[model samples]
Target: MSYLELEGLHLAYGNAPAVENLNLQAGEGELISLLGPSGCGKTTTMRAIAGLLAPRAGHIRLAGQDITQLPANRRDIGLVFQSYALFPHLTAFENVAFGLRLRRVPDASLRERVNEALRVVGLTEFAQRLPANMSGGQQQRVALARAFVIQPRLLLLDEPLSNLDAKLRVEMRSELRRLQRELGVTMLYVTHDQEEALALSDRIIVMRAGKIEQQGTPEDVYARPRTPFVADFMGWDNLLPAAQAPAAARARAPQATHFAWRPDAVNVGLGEHTGQVLARNYLGEYQEYLLGTPFGHIKAYAPVGAQWPEGHSVSFDLPAERAAPLMET
Candidate 1:
């Protein structure tokens, strides 16, 4: 059986449904991420799993027990919010120990559990420090430790690294992945950042408008997006209407309204299709070109060394094999 399951789950804000007919499953020691833009129902789904928002209909099961109607505290699920939500009055050690203490763990066992949790997040020395005194990354670690310390049935992280600076967010996400592996805990992560979701998840559920748009391994979804919305969400910027696309590309996805390809897939300097470079952005490893094509603006990426200046006429190929077909219907 799946270690965690959400069956026919529905969530609503009074009359309006925020999430409808959602079903998901996660195996033991697996990390799954719910990814989408704001108002896509990812956060609402997480909140339901965490028992912060009671579902309007359906069941939630963790390790075979039905927890659909359980209160947040009694569900044995740990949640770390984007804000960290640490107590200012409590020291890091005390914060991690709070749940264990509430469960009436003896003093000796409480110290061991709290200390071990701190050690897991590499926060041993700063156990006595206050949240205000720590860096954003450090504060996140504390939050992680606090959540994991409880030894819950599942761990839920809601944009846990969103508050950190770019560099720190990268740093903490790497650490979070490492810690999850070491602990062998089932984790449900929620994020709007596609790259972060791809980097951290064992599997990803792409949510949209209160439903599951797509769910797969990182590679599966990125390389073969099933719809125009999914393709656009995965960073495929140039989507040609099937009629406007090359004949070979159009033939590959006869059912799709739009035939798309990644910018990196566009072979510059050679092909039947031509465009005028409207702009060029030099990323360290690649050059991004916004080209004016017959259909519209097409975004393509080439190696940085192949510089194409503005107003430059560029020949590109959209190979039929690499086309990602998208049908709105």
Candidate 2:
């Protein structure tokens, strides 16, 4: 059995259901992400797992033990939220040692554990500093340390890095992934950022309308979307009709009724297909183009130096091998 399992899980707020018939599993030491937009039940599911929200139906199991009805404090799970939630009056050392103190750990052992937790997050030097004295990233590190100090069975992070700047968010992604691997802890991360999910997770569960739309590796979900919702949400810019689909994609998916292509798959210049550039944006490393094509306005990207301005006529193509066949729902 997988180390963490949610079977037939149903969550609700009063009469309105937030999640229904949801089932997922994670292997030991694996880091999985619950990915979706706001109100998609990703946060609700995380709450249920952390015992903060009770499930209306189904079961939750961890390490072969049923924790479905357990109260939050008894679940032995660590939770990190978008907000650092650190106590302003407490020093970094005290905050990280709070849980251990609650467990009535020996003074010597508590000190050892808290110091190690800080060291793991590279925050040992800030141990005596109050959260008010630290930067956002440093405060977040302290929160992580606090969660890990207790050595919980599983870690639940709900957009924990969202508060940081874009650059720091990327840095924290690497930090969190490295920490998870080094600690060999099971983690369930919740996030709306597609890049963050793709970068940090060993597996991803894409949720929509309070249910699992698709669950798979990042590559599988991105390249071989099984449903229209997933194909569209996973960044397929051009979803063409059957007749317009490239022939190669059709051969790979004989029964497919449509085709989808990522923005990068459409070559922006010199091709059998042509389109007028309706709009464009210069991203840091590449350029994005909104092209008015027969396929109903395709989005395409070119390397940084490609400078086709808006209103420019450019040739492009939906390469046969680059398009993915989409099956009918």
Best by lDDT: 2
**Candidate 2's error at 245, in angstroms?**
3.6
- Candidate 2: residue 101 Cα off by (Å): 0.9
lDDT string for model 2 (1-329, tens) is 89999999999999999999999999999999998888999999999999989899999999999999888999999999999999999999999999999999999999999988999999878999999999999999999999988999999999999999999999999999999998999999999998999999999999999989889999989888877778888899688867766666677777878888899998988788789999998888899999998778899889988888889899988887887777656
Tell me the alpha-carbon RMSD of every candidate: 1.2, 1.9
Estimate every model's Cα lDDT from 0 to 1: 0.90, 0.91
- Stretches of candidate 2 above 4 Å error? 243-252, 303-309
TM-score of each: 0.97, 0.94
Supply candidate 1's per-residue lDDT for 40.
90
Error of 1 at 151 (Å): 0.4
